[model samples]
Target: MAADHTPLTRRQALAALTGAVLMPLADPAAGSVRHERHFLFGSPVDVMLRHAPESPGDAALASVMRGLQHIHAQWNAWKPGELGRINQAFREGRSARVTPALLATIRSAARLERASAGLFNPGIGGAVRAWGFHDDVMRDGARPAAATLAAWRDAAPSLAQIEMRGDRVASRNPRLQLDFGAYAKGVAIDRALDEFAARGQGDALVNLGGNLGAMGATGWQIGIRDPFGEGLLASLATQGREAVVTSGSYERFRMLDGERCTHILDPSIAAPAQGLVSVTVLHRSAALADAAATALLVAGPLRWREVAQRMGVTQVLAVGPDGRGIASGALAARLQFASRDWRGRIATV
Candidate 1:
């Protein structure tokens, strides 16, 4: 429901403080692969190129990072950005003109909402904030009061409450806030891919906090994280230009008064999702894969197939709370798991 508003963990915070960029594979046999790194979009943003980091080709890498920063600036809800201004206007019962990118995002979000049967809602910001996810990491690691949760549910801020006309956007529900966390990373990834291609840097892998997009004939090798525990659950090699996006309930959670509540809230319940631990989607567009993976994650195991079909994504892997993974046939063909603990738990759907 929200966009890339990630909470800082000890590991990530330390890495950012130390300026450590993760480049898992830097094989010289492939080419002169240079990595350009930055901490953007609440996560590590990296670009691996087949050119020198200080060369002219690195402009694309720099451009991609700057573009992500620009999008983060506009789409960030917690900051005093363009989106916040629009939300403030809505709070005062007024309509306001938004940038073209924001408008396009709203329009596409509306389509995704219908496509996911309302499972992927950008209008759940109130409930998202109610659980104290409005900041970098949860400042108050306590669950929201029962009445506060009820109020947000009763209000039900959804796409139905939003109104988009020409360049202007507004909402009828004052309590409804927009969080693009579910969609913005993918959009930024897609934009970065396009930007890289435009800059003549075709062989590159851009990862924005594990929502990755690869643009090159060489393809890319990606590792899927275990949701219930640490380390990798599996690995997959991309087929041509492909992107891999994973949404896990365990990635970000708040320790709420002796309990752990995840960040992926079910729009139906206005609470954190349950049952499944992670969902990963493979597609050409990282944006679609990002949102689709989230929808499938929220849908859990029982209904993930239907949601995946609705999202037009055929290659997906949904991991259960027990560490077992069920993925599409296409995804199974590309996945390679070396974990001995994962053999009996994986099956092709």
Candidate 2:
């Protein structure tokens, strides 16, 4: 999920969490350790691996990053890519041919909409762009006007209306634009983990922006971003084969008409969702956690728990508009709340 806030890289967040940089891994030899950084999907993709220098870990990481680039090329919203072509086809009321991977992602997103009970909607790409989130070219003072936002918000039916058959996808709705930024990181991480495993990777941490996955390790620490202030609100341990992701309204935003506007648009109202400070979700599937976090962010205080349940998500922590820390029973059991009591008592969901 996109936010208007300046997102912290995993390294930055971990530094604040542990009073040092990143997770305390089973420190490999300096020559054997590899931490590669790259610009993928307009966000930082970080991979830390514990493999000997002479091994193929370097090449494996390179291949994984390249795979992510290829995926971004297909579905990225901003540039002239396969997703752009698909949007054009939708505009023309024609079917667009998609790779098996793209088709699968589209179908998966559609299922997410259903599974989340319409809480997750990729069809808001048009409204998101209108709100000036489609491009990171950063038009500082530019944002959609009330009228434009309304028009785009009402322009299309929900994602449930899109029709897909085999590898062909079609959308007759004029405002039906798809932006997979919310889950792309997690999907990429899953892909990377699959690649690493095939190449006999050792313990590793795959972090894309704030969406992270850890494998071949135990009790790795993660810090939940305190959306309201500095430092983290809590630290938690990750189970093997787990992914953690957080979404906040301020993560990606610009000042519109002298007002702070974020990328987390509400599909129902075609406006920015309010009242939620942040939402963090953890699950085994990075992709699912990514999308579910966004949905729960939009769900905010009242409906977040219900959405989490619908998504089969038992681990969640949410900051409400009132600045209270709310978490699911499962998450609360595992979380160690930071001593910053100013953030308030933990409220169970």
Candidate 3:
């Protein structure tokens, strides 16, 4: 899920519980070891792997990191070869055969795009890059001009323009450059969790920069940060593995004319969302949760609860611009509202 803060836009949140069994095979050469590694993927990835005392977990950790390296090699847009491949297909005006892994991701993107009625469009790659969000290209005092935003939106495609055949995929709109920034972490976390499960690792937690998932029968307790406070607003003690995502206007933004603008743009208008400071959604899949949170971000306060209810998302918390907000009915059942004032909490069916 997303952090409840300003200035720290991309903070990761992992839902971890107590009493989960993490038994690693023992090794004679060393005591319990936790291997930590940092690598560059679509974005920066920080991975942590732990083993029992005296367990040979380094090798296994290395193997996991190697798999992640492969993922970056194919997915990293900055990589010359990968860029060339995508560019070449666009230049040729032909559909390129995307790897199964990539196709699966796009398929999920397509689903979210449709489900959210274009609110959560993956076709925002151009807009994202134009805003200098890719390759860590943050520009000082940089904001897209109205004309630039119009052009980018015009050039962007809906997910329908993307076609997947077998393992090969093609974009009908050559201008459509796919960016999984919103959902890749969920996919990566799922990948890592699968790897842990294959080795019979019990109760493992995989947190890819805050997109968290788990394996085995153990429940993971995740903290949902307080948007305006120092500690967690609430914690979820869940039995099954799920994807938790947050979209907050506080994450990435610039103060222009004494006003704050965030990175979560409205694709239809190509402008920053206004009102409703932030939103967090808990769902069964990371990709779904990621895309759904964006949808809610765009829906704003007036219609957020209505849309969320229609989508069957029971656990949603919105922090309002006036510091007055409401939690979803399902979420309210689990967590108490701090504000007892009649103005703060409003529930509608």
Candidate 4:
């Protein structure tokens, strides 16, 4: 089914512009938490970190930010860097040692792959490239040929074929090239939060393009983007000592053949997910929530409740393309849906 690619409303656009211009000036000395928004993982990222009462916390946060940036700088396939190393590994047809940090991430990726039954494979780089999502190759209404799709489909590595032995990871199939875009940003946030916490930061919230993680006793409020209405889908109001993450097909897309295509390519089908438009999850860790969002997207509505139950996720919310949504048992009980008088919206469940 074809979907519509909606641009941000004037208000939303203004908010984004305001955030971009004002975020860099946010310093810890302000005695309040600051929200910093940026583009990463080929998607938008927003981070909220509490200011440290002392100069040391400020310096620590700044250093943590720099480290996060470096991780993305080296590993972002959209640009160029350590991705070439992965490419090299593929060429060599052998396992490669990744940085301790990256190894932790890849190990998490492997675990998610096993959990999702291969639906969230990282070895879809060939398919992603062929689809022209890596570069601006889809410009001017470009679409890959059926033959190219066939080649990628044939070459893409199965999750089962990937081998991860701590700091080293390899693919049984030489054609398999890994792309962790689906979950890397969340992992980055997790790492950043960990680093900040280790430095004695009181409370911190890391939003790597949308995926978010928070540490400490202070709970954060998050506004869920509405799919068919004005403003937030709903706000999660709680002060949990955990992290929250959300993802949606509503962001990042290119039009082709009179069809709107999103950037969330399902490794199982080598195409973007169908039916669902947005999915959000709250959990103890950003990595799990982020990976779960993708897996739920691929699973669609059919297996959502079951998977969420199996994974022991705290909560989940999903909006279908038809403007209908369902919330998990946990979330339904926790969040207060928007009122119609104010937003002309209603929530069932």
- The candidate that wins on lDDT is 1
What TM-score fits each model? 0.90, 0.87, 0.76, 0.83
Kindly give the stretch of ten consecutive residues in candidate 3 with the minimal lDDT sum. 16-25
Alpha carbon lDDT of each predicted model = 0.77, 0.73, 0.59, 0.65
Model 2 lDDT per residue over 158-232, tens place: 667678888788877867888888877778878888888888875667777767887765445566766766566
lDDT of 3 at 96: 73
The residue-by-residue lDDT of candidate 1 on 90-130, one tens digit each, is: 77888988999888888888888889988898888888888
The lowest-lDDT stretch of 10 consecutive residues in candidate 4 is 18-27
Which of the two, 1 or 2, has more TM-score? Answer: 1
Residue lDDT tens for model 3, 1-349: 1222222112212122110111111223432336454645523354444343324345545666776677666665545545337645754678676767777777777877777767778777777666656645434565667788787777766768866677665666766766666666667766776675566554455555445555435455455555554434445544456656667776566654455667777778877777787777876666667777778888898877666765567778777777656666566455432223312343422
Ranking by lDDT: 1, 2, 4, 3
